[model samples]
Target: GKGSHSNDVGAIQADLPVPSDVLIYYYEVTVKDAGERGVIAVGFADVHFRLSRQPGWEPNSYGYHADDGNKFHNSGKGEEYGPPFVQGDTVGAGIHLENREIFFTKNGKKLGAAFQNVKATLFPTIGLHSQNEHVEINFGAKPFQFDIEGMIAEEREQRQLAVLRSRIPAHACHDIVCSYLKHYGYAETLLSFDQGAYTEQVAKDEETPQAFGLEDRKRVRNMLFEGDVEGVRQLLIGKQPQLAQLQEDPLAVGGSGSGHKGAPGEPFGDAFFHLSVQQFIELLRQDKIGEAVEHARSSLSTFQGRSHQHDQHLQDVLALLAYKSPGQSPVGQFMSTAQREKVADIINTAMLESSATASASGSGSGSGTSAGAGGG
Candidate 1:
């Protein structure tokens, strides 16, 4: 609504304060009519801001006025800021929480920072000082005229780079990287990194007892990644004969012959399901539709109706067959290298967890021997 008189300055504040959890918060306003005084203002103000007073005329408030293009905070006096906005002009205000700075934009062009060290639980506010001061506010219901997404991305990249540049002991960093490689079964990379160690401390750390069956885990991971699902199955069975038994009697998980309280097949069932899906995907990728269908019927059909998640996954996997170019299909994400990596990561984590469980239980029955099978 338009202001009734010069002193009848009208202002409005959002019901909620600007969110501080995020890296940035911003809003924009389009001046439909600058009116008699062209004194429209857009900024932020604390809860105590008076509705009848223009924002920035009192304490704990900030504003950019239209007539003079000056910014005001905690005072009636204004400071030089950006170009004055008028009718048909779009203006924006933003708070960068990381830097504690407030800035404005005119017609989608960013103005420099207007205030520093802004520490207030402020609300998005607008002020009208005279008649016909028509304006429209956009609180991100639509695309922002400013590239706020890009700003957030840049901030995240800068923060990550800062962390990377922080000082840390070389041996400590090497050990962390080496552990990551070993955990993911990147045996070849681990070997290369070990050989490239620049100091004796790193070389000595390498001699520490590695995870059990590091080579086996690496081989299975490589085979899965290479689309050799059959090879992975064969290798697992050869290395851990118990896996063949588990496949025959899934209820025998954890080697608790009589009362195994866990889910039937437990993690092994999960691993084999993922592997079967990956095998089906690989077959489809090779355009062997008949073979893929047969494999799905033999392996995947048994997993259906087991759970909603399993049914949904099977549906998505089968959806790929309807597309001549599965890579471009809606379900194409399942065909990506990322999908294979996801399965491999899950398998690796399952193996590590099973081995850790077996070692902790101190079972002389060699339950850890089937850790790789459990992952498969």
Candidate 2:
């Protein structure tokens, strides 16, 4: 059926509204026949849009007419836009959610944005007027004729470049990079960065009281990264002898081990737990199942039911024993160097937090006191 009079236009809408959560949404329509008057319309409209009127004849609707090559919005009057679309022409309509703009394409060529400030839950709508007008809609079920992916990529790159171009304090940037390198056990890189980028800052850092024992922390971090869990444990305990005392209490070791309690040896309890787990994993890697089981029983068994994360991690680690080739197991990620690095990072953070607490308390107690004086 076709329109009999000027206002007798027929339009169809999608079952659901255009998704608003994404950055952009686009659809295409292929005109099967331009019909007698070639009065076809493709665009978006709100729920209140009338099917008996051209899509852009009323409020909260937008459309591009095939006959006049004009864009219309909120009125029957249209403005000059793209070329007229006809049979076999693939026309596209897209909504840019972030920018609140609507754009159209004709035969895979974009005609630029036509509407802005769109703020409604609109549906993809198409209108047909006059006899024999027909169109088939494609809601991204097939490849898009327009280069939408390229457009998205270009937008993302532009945003990233904008962020990189923003200015920040030079010292702040240096400190952030330095802290990152130290936290990740990149000792060589940190040294090169300090010597190369901020030679003067390195000298100033050496004179600061907080810089004391930085080398020891780096050594412990390196040991952990080298898969020497016992070495890290020994080094940490040697530096803070109270860590050995805290390890005797299972509750202290498992309870809130990840937090800095401001108590001597309390923070190290969590670090010790991580080291024990790593030690068990190392024994398993060496094919010493008996030693690994004994280690888990003596060290990790106490951590059970203490925390959900610990329990789940312990379960995953134990599952590795079931596979003859543990590297092929579902929990095989725990067997990689990346796992060791992750554990090292946790231990390094605990050490840094504990040291910061010691430094803060030491300065509060007296001016002449050393940072480690509060650790005892």
**Shift of residue 191 alpha carbon in model 2, Å:** 27
Candidate 2 clashes between residue pairs 3 or more apart in a chain or in different chains: none
lDDT of each: 0.75, 0.77
Q: Considering every candidate listed, which one attains the maximal lDDT?
A: 2
Model 1 lDDT tens row, 1-376 = 4555645888999999999799999999999999888999899999999988878887889999999999999888999998889899999999998899999998888998998999988999999988878999999898778877657645664564344334455577788989999999999999988878737543333211212355666677778778988887776566445556555543355433425433222445567678789999999889999999998788788677767887899999999989999989999999987688778767655555554444333333333333332332
Model 2 whole-model lDDT (C-alpha atoms): 0.77
Clashes of each: 0, 0
- Native-to-model Cα distance after best TM-score fit, residue 13 in candidate 1, in Å: 0.6
Could you give the C-alpha RMSD of every candidate to the true structure, in order shown? Answer: 14.4, 16.4
Which tens-of-lDDT digit does each residue in 122-142 have in candidate 2? Answer: 999999998988899988788
